[model samples]
Target chain A: MIELYLFLFIMLIAAVIATEIKDLLAAVISLGAVGFSVAIMFILVQAPDLAIVQIVVEILTIVIFVAVVFRTTHIDETIGKRFASTHILSMVLFSLFAFLFLAAVVQSLRELPRFGYATMRVASEYIRLGLSECGGANIVADVILDFRALDTLGEATVLFTSVIGVLALMRKIGRKR
Target chain B: MRGMSLVVKVVTNIVVGFIFIYGVYIILHGHLTPGGGFAGGVIIAGALVLRILAFGVEPVSEKRAEERASAFESLGALLFIGIAFAGLIIGGAFFLNFLPQGTPLRLLSGGIIPLCNIAIGIKVGAGLFTIFLALAAIKYVMED
Candidate 1:
């Protein structure tokens, strides 16, 4: 529990650093730190699958971000330059929004069941019969690949579509002679 | 992008193969382990990205690699859909577990699940690598 809190703290600090930093590359690295902290939090919460995916995806994202940064300007020119009235107004509005978001989060947190006591209807059945039906030791795999295969298929289609979109955009407009 | 230092290249040459194999292992044993298609596929893509970043290649060869990645991506998607169509045509249901479900906890078990994992693994790995290559190959107009 304490370890989880520590990770959460690390994530929050890294997130703030990621947003507040001036150097684009440093900011990207900070964001990677934030992501790694979140991955650690996932592991602490006993979700190794989520942790593995989060770690790998985070690494790829950081790599992509760094590549983009390498091809562009390194320093952000706009940040910390001036504090205009509009900036102050936006900050005020952001704080208000943050307060409201916190209130909503608190309400939702209150509604959630106590830790380690989550109740389930469909999940229980999946746990009991997933092996016999799907013949897999990993129930999560069985659920996703067998019972919810349509969802997986839809996700694959979505990925494929995005890849096509990227290819189209890059080949047509992203290159100039 | 230019190649990194020789140390980086050497390390990548040593590590990339292991990473690719590990991704395949994850995908193959998904039904018996925690990671499945999506995570394993992402890992494989990461390995490719690492290799490309460490050892930059000629633009011409990179273009060829990008085209190959695109083809592989399409092939994976086609294979997944073909599997579903096969299940429909033979079993009269979409994504039916038509294959024999062997004993649980074994590699050969989980009739259609492992197959789906492999298909998804291929699709995701190839797709992500294609995206990265496309992004990297983009010509920056401002460079002029």
Candidate 2:
């Protein structure tokens, strides 16, 4: 649609402007704006979860940059050298890679089975019988907490490991001081 | 540093308060809403950054705040693990929702999920706050 094209055009312009901006702080703000725009696009594409994650990550990244900039006032010196030739080359390569990957994903999307069919045949039957077997009220909850409990356990373990890692790092820093 | 006009100080205070309140709202409504622990926590951290920038770290008592944040981080992690272990002790699998599911689509309905969100919010907020403080401390030490 015309609106989508307009949005894409604006995003492209914003991306170029962000990259071209001489001031590091301005560039960072512009990049954040572009990220927000992309997040909106993700929402429009029916990926609300991904959109939220993207926006959150973008905000964190922007805050980190702002903190760094405040501590170090000389932004011009921090802006690394910009080479036109390498930029173009890399851009082309990146575009090609993205195009190929997107093509594969689109192919997969077409080939994938519809969730409704599987749900009706496999999941629904299991759910109908699950109350008698699992003693859970909700079928979906039963599937997630009971049938796939191992996966949930693994995820919890991963969170535990990361928290431990963070603690260890903090302690190590404390000892160094 | 103390020579700043009253207008600037008032404006900065209002802005900082707004950011902090917004962050808390996001964290509290995370389970039923779009915003979650990480987003809300980062927003809170941003408010701290703004406060530090407007009123320098010295005025804010950054070191003491850093210590408090570290304690909060530890408590958050502990609370998260404790919730998980509670399920195991209740004869259910790990991380199981032991409490009654009051009603779906309600804020208080998702028993463990809301608790998990709170724990995550605390962990993220404190973790980020600590990192910022540590980084600032490094700069402070180097300058001194």
Count of clashing residue pairs in every prediction: 0, 0
In terms of DockQ, the best-performing candidate is 1
> Cα deviation of A25 in candidate 1 (Å)?
2.2
Top lDDT hit: 1
lDDT of 2 by residue, A49-154 (tens): 4576588678778877876775576257533565579887997999999999999999999876773355347666675764444344434434444455456445
lDDT of 1 by residue, A83-163 (tens): 999989999999999999999999999988787666867778888899999898898898888888888899999999999
How well is each residue in B1-144 modelled by candidate 1, as lDDT tens digits? 589999999999999999999999999999999898999999999999999999987677877898999999898898888888889999999988889899988999999889888998999999999999888877532343
Candidate 1 stretches greater than 4 Å from native: A173-177, B140-144
DockQ, structure candidate 1: 0.80
lDDT of each: 0.89, 0.67
The per-residue C-alpha lDDT of model 2 at residue A164 equals 52
Model 1, CA-based lDDT: 0.89
The C-alpha local distance difference test score for the whole of candidate 2 amounts to 0.67
Q: After superposition, how far is residue A58 of candidate 1 from its true place, in Å?
A: 1.0
